[model samples]
Target: MSIRSYLLFSIYRFEYWMQKINKKGAAYMLALQDVTKKYGNQVALDEVNINIKEGEIVGLVGPNGSGKTTLMKILNGLIVNYEGEVVRNESIGALIESPKYFEHKSGLYNLKYFNDLFGTKQDVGKLLEQLNMDHYKKKSVKKYSMGMKQRLGIALALTAQPEYLILDEPTNGMDPSGVREVLRYLRRIAERNNIGMLISSHILSDIESLCDKVYLIHNGKIKKEHRPLVGFAVEDKDIGKIEHILLDMQDASITDNGIVKVPKSESKKVSQLFDEHGIEIKQIEEKSVSLEEMYFDMVEEDYK
Candidate 1:
């Protein structure tokens, strides 16, 4: 092989090895041991213990009153209170908030300062370039738009190249295009660098897109752990179609709140018919439960 070809091959191999090393150490990047957060009489997080692996994309989810923000704060050392141990390694990158930057300073200037503080000689320009923000490097923070600011946030978070990244609503205030860009870039980083990410978003669709595993927190406690809830969301028109099909087929019945429950003998048959008819199924399982269904069921049971 030519010398240049050999060099490029070696570089790729080195990058792969680095990712492998990061992945190997990702078993327990962050561990929350019996943690609880209290705000006066309210329980923000009730004795929640969670272990996040090093190189996994774990999305934290919950309803409006859920403890996603609290859990993230505890993980990022932003909230020092609560009971239980928040154990994390030294190298941790947190975008828990849209961190303030020097309004008058160029983006590059900001990275230089951050790199100095972190005592790491990372290539700041290349990092910005990788995030497609190199063109915006010389501009002051004040000149950047909100979406640009989010892009800058991502660039800053990756500057440390920490194995663990904590993102709190990473795509908040972003347009659809911006959200897509951020998710794509994050996935690239996670795959390339084996960066373990803890992403929290109130938008279930965003969480579904970015994470393979999700943690659902409700009532200050973890309601679901490491479960990817997959189902279809058929429109009202499609719902009627599904109902009609179920009624005519006799193997399945529509349960309360529009859930189509199927007997084990005909789950596959029901799924095939609906899929063939272009019925947008919110979800279908042989005998699997869903987050939405599970929540409503629990609520009804509690009321009783």
Candidate 2:
């Protein structure tokens, strides 16, 4: 191979090795340990710990007044007077809330302005194209819809090609279609660029579909950490009998949909139990637990 090709190949191999080491070593791009924030006498965040590994997409979810916003602010350095250590990658991008732009300027012009301010050499046209906003690149921001604005906000955050992104309620005020569009763009950006993202949203469905892990906060505390569930699903008419059999097994529960969730490791035992008890199995399949159900379950338990 030519010298140029050999150099490129060498670089690729080096990058692959670095990524492998990062994964095995738990090299987090951002981490917040025992973070706490207060407002007057009220605690907004208490002993919250979170970590985002390189190229991972993490979700922050909680009810209103549940300190989700406060935690996000701390991550972005918007609130620095809080307790705890926040370690983050030096190169970071964020869209905490609504992005500010010249109302009368074109979208492309606004992006160019920020690019200049940040001394970044990012290609304006390519950024707009990636966000599906190339057609309206020259249109005045005043005429852009809310969804369009949100897309532009994301483009602005990406101007510096940062390694990590922090977004708060990116789909707020958007219609269903708009929400889906934004989510699709975000997922594509994260995977294609191999960037870590911490996204906070009230939309549980979006979180369920996109996030690799989720942090549920309640009453100023990191109440629970949930991963995308993986298990076996068994449906039987004798649901009550099956429940009794699996009662002593850990990680076994019957969902409200009347499906018994058994750990994949215990699938054979579950099958044998059903056969020995003569319980009729209507269907069996592999399934994942919905984030909405998990969120509600966590919140309910906290209340109790």
Candidate 3:
């Protein structure tokens, strides 16, 4: 090759390599590499590694005392005396444990106090409206319901307009409707702001619905990572025939009650196959495995 051509190729390759490196570095908003935490030799966390990237929601799930909270605390800088590298590339907002507010103060006053403390000019009124707490903004926190207070805590977390959010049980102690409201707002906020979030929750259904990926922790370590399944049930009178058909298909299983569980993505194909085979479908309902089921499965395996 000519000397000029070789020089140009080398320059192009150098630029490409630099761009790749830059992209990799900017991909994750927060990363914990080989992080470990201990309390008087009782290992609260054992070399935990987690990464949260832009515009992604990651769920942390485990039973009590299983290092989920410890991992979150480390990420939030609550437990700082830990071992490992923590890379936080952008501003963070966190709501860990119970939010302490002056019971006598109005919700708006509490928010205003935090806003000033964070040195942010975020519009408290707008935030309250977004969280559906505007109506009760003037009411004292002591009079607020559990769900309302939870929403207020989330609003406090957003006072800083952080690039990453860390929430531990953001919906704890809420009724069904309250849980739905909190999850809905969280989803909207994450999408609209392009924020990455690390959420730890005991409610598996909330995790399964809201998270793009899930990490299961146990015994101070990450036991498993799971992509939650979107399950579909196919039921018919001839259970044996349905089982045989599903057995031939990938990612299909028959439950103990003769219901066939297939991936939701393949629901159309399964329906077509059933029709072609003259299997009169009684019902085909979409469902998901509860987080409780997945958690217990992992825990049981670990104990065994």
Candidate 4:
């Protein structure tokens, strides 16, 4: 193994033991207990509570200027003047806001630079390959496209092989295809490295697809939490029967469009129920809650 790989492995093992010994069997990798922040007189975050376990991906969803950036900044220690408590049990890698790089330097050089600065000893070549940017690794960052720069930003964040990640609008400047690829890479890396990740994004589809749990923030307060839901679109027969059967599950409901919704956790059970009852499912909808439905619901509740 390379020096960087060896060092990272050693650190990972050491931290693993430390976490076990210190937490007394708590599996939480990071916990925010009533964390709040303000900018002068303006409250940016209001008593936000969140938790992310190792290997779990959590999403912070909100409109622009709705405290998402503030919360991420606090988690990354870029902004520390806050209220309540943040319990972090792991090292973090982050890509917050626009990823800034030495415009004239090669992407590889930037990675090597950070590695040297942090003594991380990362395999810069391998990292770029993983990000599908190896071909451009030697190219100047100034000549790279927005999406490429975004990928480089992510690569920079991972150079430390951190136990946790904080990504703010990680898909910014990427085309749809680029966005999908980045999300796939992120999910794969999180699972492979057992990294706890907290991602903040205004794009509901991205959050819905990537996050296991989601927190909705509005006006600086966490308005609600949800496990991303999946809508099973039943057709060609007995939709009502399937919907009726699913209703027995908590929060299972049918939309006006005849889509039966259930938690992603229950998707297999849903299929089994259908198979047993001889119900035919025409299609499975996306796994995340409908953005319009969820946003409208939150807006109404906020006004109430």
Sort all candidates by lDDT, best to worst.
4, 3, 2, 1
| Candidate 2 TM-score, C-alpha based | 0.72
| Candidate 1 lDDT over residue span 1-304, tens digit each | 6534653664565444333222334347676778888999999999897776656688877677678878887776566657777666546787766676777889899888778766788899988887678789999989988777877777777777788888888888888877888798888888778788899887767776567567777788876654543233354444666777767655455655666665443455666877787766665543345445655554455457
Candidate 3, which ten residues in sequence have the lowest lDDT sum? 15-24
Q: Which consecutive 10 residues in model 4 have the weakest lDDT in total?
A: 16-25
Q: What is the lDDT, from 0 to 100, of the residue 225 in candidate 2?
A: 76
Question: Over the full model, what C-alpha lDDT does candidate 2 score relative to the true structure?
Answer: 0.78
Off by over 4 Å in 4: 1-25, 229-291
Candidate 3 TM-score, C-alpha based? 0.72
lDDT of 2 by residue, 57-147 (tens): 8999999999987887677656667777777645678887777778899999998987986689999789899778989999999999987
Compare the candidates by lDDT and give the number of the best one.
4
Better of 1 and 2 by lDDT: 2
Q: Give the TM-scores of the predictions, in the order they appear.
A: 0.67, 0.72, 0.72, 0.74
Q: What is the lDDT of residue 303 in candidate 3?
A: 76
Off by over 4 Å in 2: 1-26, 231-288
What are the lDDT scores of the predictions, listed in order? 0.71, 0.78, 0.78, 0.79
- Residue 91 displacement in candidate 2 (angstroms): 1.2
What digit string (tens of lDDT, one per residue) describes model 3 on residues 36-148? Answer: 88999799889988888787788999889999877876676555577777777677788888767878989999889878876899999999998888899999999998778
